[model samples]
Target: ERLHSYETKRANLQAIERLKDHLISVQLTDPSSKHRIRRAVSEIGKRLSSIRNLLRDRKLELDCAVNAAENFQDDLKKLQKFCEQTEKAIQLVESATIFVPSGTDLDYVRLHEPEADEVANRLEKQWKDVFSLGEAVIDEQFGIVSFDTILEILAV
Candidate 1:
């Protein structure tokens, strides 16, 4: 879940922050080395902040998708009820007024929407299992993937 990712990122960022603070506390022998360490800490903090933002975005996206699916089901149900009512009115009213001897022209096709909750849940579960697949192709950590690695996998 995205919550787990947020927690993991929080923990890692906290650990990094602790290391940065310790680095700042210890008197570095070289001024240049101290400056470099501070810069590294700043960069790591920025990256962690970005990850936090991305996690929030993903959570919002998933929530929206689920809500849309729920709304879709509700609308589908309303449509079914409306059609049923129309068909019933056609059967009762048309037989008396229009003087149809046999059946009416309306076709009440029975349609059932599959469990929207189950479909959404299944997609979320599958994505949870498959989330790591994209990470293999895009090593966002280093912004690089070796061609040799790709070639070896392709050979497989």
Candidate 2:
């Protein structure tokens, strides 16, 4: 909505610029008419200058706001992906199943030990990553991003 307004105003400003140029080039013979035209043109020039300055400032502000919003959204997407990957890791660890034959208990234990240790290491790494992401979010984006929204995504 704001963008649309800005575009419309910018177009109007351009049209006014063209009209001002046209006015400046107009030929007038009478002294009073020429003086009035000159005064009107001068006033229009001042007003247009002020409007241009205001619009430029507003455009810069809007651009900054848009960039901030995009960055926030990118952060949220990264957090969401991390949450999903963590959940998958947790589920995989939780659902791990081991089977051993009755007479081969010792052999099965020897074979499973390395895999179990690897799983443990991966789980530990994922936990640390999740913790780090949480801390970073709290420290950096606390005021800018919505706390409850972040929490909800984390909980998922």
* TM-score of model 2 vs. true structure: 0.50
TM-score of each: 0.50, 0.50
lDDT of 1 at 144: 24
At residue 29, candidate 2 shows an lDDT of 46
Would you list the C-alpha lDDT of every candidate in the order shown?
0.58, 0.59
Q: Using lDDT as the measure, which candidate wins? A: 2
Candidate 2 lDDT (Cα, whole model)?
0.59
lDDT tens digits, residue span 17-55, model 1: 788778777885467777887898889888878877897
